[model samples]
Target chain A: MKHSASVLALAMGLGWSGMAVAQEMKAEVIHWWTSGGESAAVKVFADQFQKAGGTWVDTAIAGGANARTAAINRTVGGTPPAMMQFNTGKQFDELVENGLLNDVEAVAAEQKWKDKIPPAILAATVRNGKMYAVPVNIHGQNWLFYNTDVLAKVGAQEPKSFDDLFPILDKVKAAGLIPLAFSGQKTWERNLFNAVMLGQGGAKLWLSVYGDKDPAAVKSAEFKNVAETYAKLRNYVDAGAPGRNWNDATALVIQGKAGFQIMGDWAKGEFIAAGKTAGKEYGCVVLSKAGGGYAMGGDVFAFPKTKDANTLKAQAVLEKVLLDPTTQIEFNNKKGSIPVRLDVDTSSMDVCAQKGAKMVADKNQQAPAQELLTPPAVTGAVEDVISSFWNTPGQSVETFQDKFAAALKSI
Target chain B: MLALRPRLASKLSAWLALSPATTILVVVYVGCTAWTVWISMTASRMLPSSTFVGLRQYDALFANERWQISVSNLVVFGVLFMIASLVLGFLLAVAIDQRVRAENVLRSVFLYPFSMSFIVTGLVWQWLLNPTYGIQAVGRGFGFETFRFDWIVRQETVIYCLVIAGVWHAAGLVMAIMLAGLRGIDEDIWKAARVDGLPPWRVYVSIVIPMMGASFATAAVLLATSVVRLYDLSVAMTNGGPGIASEVPAKFVMDHLFERQNIGLATAAATSMLITVAAVVAPWIYIQSRRRRAA
Candidate 1:
């Protein structure tokens, strides 16, 4: 009798699993969005997918590189999750080339994503004339986030350009506050350098250096000026800046200990988490002395190829849910980025995001980030040069420019 | 014939049991190594491709400034770490071997750092060496306003900080090994030295250290292996910061492998490391084997 009962229970479990397989659309998504704000942003998709009668399976990996490596390995190993996340760039280029990823062309065409999403983001997803990934949001990579209280304490106004920022930084320094809340890691160093390039050298030089890989562009006087500006700003960073994390630097600004932090729009998530409203406690701006542009980078979910019918169905559902206008607004609100779909009503987003949306909508202001222009290899090579220059204050601008040109051409 | 049959059966079973591990060693280690060498010659980026580019990848790797820095940093770290660990460990063992009080506790304390992972040791050292909140801050709090110990933040001296942490973590293990060697020295050796009117330091230098050759070899081999695969400590402590000054070969290989998405370069770096290790080990291995044969 006991054996019969055990068999019966086993049969029931099998029946339930079979039922789930036949009836439910389950998507196991692997992503690196494990931060508090990032997780909340991802939850919007999960809830929306559930509302659309699909089950959401969450696999939150902590680091971007680790998550991508795991996802790429699993996809290659033939036991991939239903969907995976990548920074909206060439990270998934090989997967697309190898035909390991399924094209979201059908969903994209059906939803008219080409019309809704920005051309730059759309172009990144559409490799070889077919959309292989779904861009979810656009993050402005260069935003000067300053504590309003800190600036007010120093009797400084909001700096609209890089030229205006130096004097404000000086005032902050003279007042005994850290002029720049800086993270001294390689990635942040590169980010700060890029911010300087976009603001001082303008979008043309930014694109020429990264997009064209132009050696002459690096040798130009504008590039040297940008290099000099980045070096000059290094003077304001504290001794504790080395090996510091990005959020810790952001925390310094939030606590009014520092005057400014040149970071990505994702820093908004930190401000939101701290319950400090933008324009009141903290202010955000994109500085451009040369009529600069908004440097855009963001996340995308690429669906790995699968023969399973239910998994394919689940991917389809996820694609639509990710791009739904309302969902896009809601997700980006928590994500600290603008919706990839520029047509969406963004009044619900904060003032910072609204400003980003305005810049993204303008053709001239829509600057592609370094990742979008160059592959990870070139980006990293250039990043090494930037970091070396930043860390070594005595390095000359001409040497930096020469090194930058060499790095750009290294790959 | 009956006795031979049982012995043969036992030997066959042993061979059968060893087959799996032997197969794994050949396939996983030797096979993957060959594959890495092959991939290093190709124009592989995010994934391995068959577009062979000869020694182009190696040329690029050598030309790369970061790679050069990483190689030199590894050399500096490896030499300093091994020598310091050996000297410190030997001293600790000798001090404890003097039949000091609480010898058991002292032995455990010496071996404790070895039990902690490199990551933990690195983090603790990073905190201790941090200028703002670490030793310098503590010194300033005591009114030593001119105190300074910020080597970890400087590019020129950051690698030494790693060596310092590496020595701290590894010295204990060395001490344990040396202590065992010291204990194994027959008590009669000490009595003989006393009869000859040899001082303790003289006995240790002339007789005991030479006798502890095997112990020193064992400890050196362990420390050398750790030196070659040093990744977590540098990662945890500095993450190759201050403009790639503290970067090492393993970190270079790893960063290129996944983050940079340049498998060809990564594999090339890996192959270079393999060749370096093999070049150093091959001669020593041959000498050791020749000596064993002579014995």
Candidate 2:
């Protein structure tokens, strides 16, 4: 029975993943990619690692935070897995400081990651002038996904900036469709607000607040305008927005009951689930008011230090397969992110993804998500302020601005 | 000495027999509690460390808006839920004791909910409570146009829906316990009541209800623990949402301990809960012991 399952797992390898190789080296990878598409994408890595004579022990927790806590606990308890994922951001900062992670400098050097991977990504993966993690795919945060049928019925064109976004939202309301589908969970609320900030307040405001943590910048009239824009979006959402999952909101757009949703590129999963194709059934662009660029964040796997020789070998194989250009393309194709490598092919990717890849290829257009810029604690604090202002009726825009400035300044 | 096997234990032997249990109690229960209390004082994050930050975590904790909301929501939920459960439970028990036909079937009707886990029931509640596809829309579909049952989505009324679900999940256990107490009553009570020419309701309310002290005590303790350890219902029902209108302490502790990666704050929350529980339960224990002594 075990042999039959192993054979099935081998045949199911997407392209170059392991069945033959995995039999030799066993590596436990703890991650949070448990949804259908996410699991399918992860299987690519597992298969590739297996093909390379390494075993991929998949321990997938459902939620990102749940997985991280488990991984952190295991590492601290001195029974760490071979490789575990962290967002390419400040989440692993404490762990790195605590010396719980092993430097993946060897893999970086082997893959010429410094040359192939984006500087933003490399910078995220590297801390203190040493590589400590492997950068995988880049998920374009802040994409505006819209149902074409709903938009056409309302006789509205795709809005270029958020100014164009509002009138269309009104039209969507008049059409009796959901104006803007929003998931009011804290993380996504913050995501939508940040998208508005980046699109409206522009890259400079984003950098100052997150990258520089300049309180003065957060207190500026520009920041106030961003806060107002973020709050203005509240009126367009349905009453059922609060506590809804991102996918549920995405489902609204997919079902054509909602005209639009401002979400990450990963929202493409919901569209795909409904058998809708991008550019044919739906339209997408980065929902920037200032027309800057897509905000990018993605997954990264860091190897934990281990005494087992087999574990070390498995980590090496997994790293190789993840960064291998073909595997990157195949994985991200199913995963809905651009390949981490800039020089990858664009022919097979959908139009929106191709656009994202092109924008990423251009040096001036790539802006990292706050994950790549700030600590989760700081992001969580800002999220609270954002969600509060968004949810509460009769809330003063000025009060929101002040609190927003305070949160940014403190961070 | 007259038995087939001689009795072996004396005072020294009894001590030997009890050594394992005593050691386990000290090492497992007391030791874990002490460890949690100690960790509450430190500034640990993803992992435990030796940095003593003293009440700083707790200070931050109290200042958190969500935590304050959780405490308030819990107070409202706990009181209303406890009273509603007891009342409904007692009524159901009394109804079942009226010598109705299909008594077992009727009891099962009241008791079946207790057999199911909160996770399954919470989902059913969530689906049934959802505005678009649930009771509200269904009622509207049936041509009752102005129907509005959106308490699940509203900030103010979401807690009541939670109470409704909590009552459904819990009241059954209370009924079963109360029913046992009711059934154990002697026929002499009815005879005495008849001799006095008392009404059926008054006899049951005055004489029979007071006699069921142990049943009420058991039910209160069980429900009180559920009220304090109310993580699953909150999670399965509303997930502390519609902007945290339904947040509770256990969910807060579990979230911080695992998701937030702030073990210090989580432990602090746990220790505070332990203290509160101790304060309430200690006096009850004292009263119970005194009653035992008097008996």
Question: What does DockQ give for each predicted structure?
Answer: 0.72, 0.48
Model 2 bad stretches (over 4 Å): A1-23, A401-411, B1-21
Candidate 2 C-alpha lDDT tens digits along B180-215: 999999999899999999999999889998999999
Q: Against the native chain B, what TM-score does each candidate's chain B reach?
A: 0.96, 0.93
Could you list the CA RMSD of all candidates, in the order they appear?
Answer: 4.1, 6.0
True contacts kept of 2: 0.31
Task: Write the residue-wise lDDT of candidate 1 on B119-220 in tens digits.
Answer: 999999999998879998999999999999999999989999999999999999999999999999999999999999998999999999999999999999
TM-score per prediction, in order, is 0.96, 0.92
Model 1 chain A: ten consecutive residues of lowest lDDT: A14-23
- For model 2 the local lDDT of residue B101 reads 93
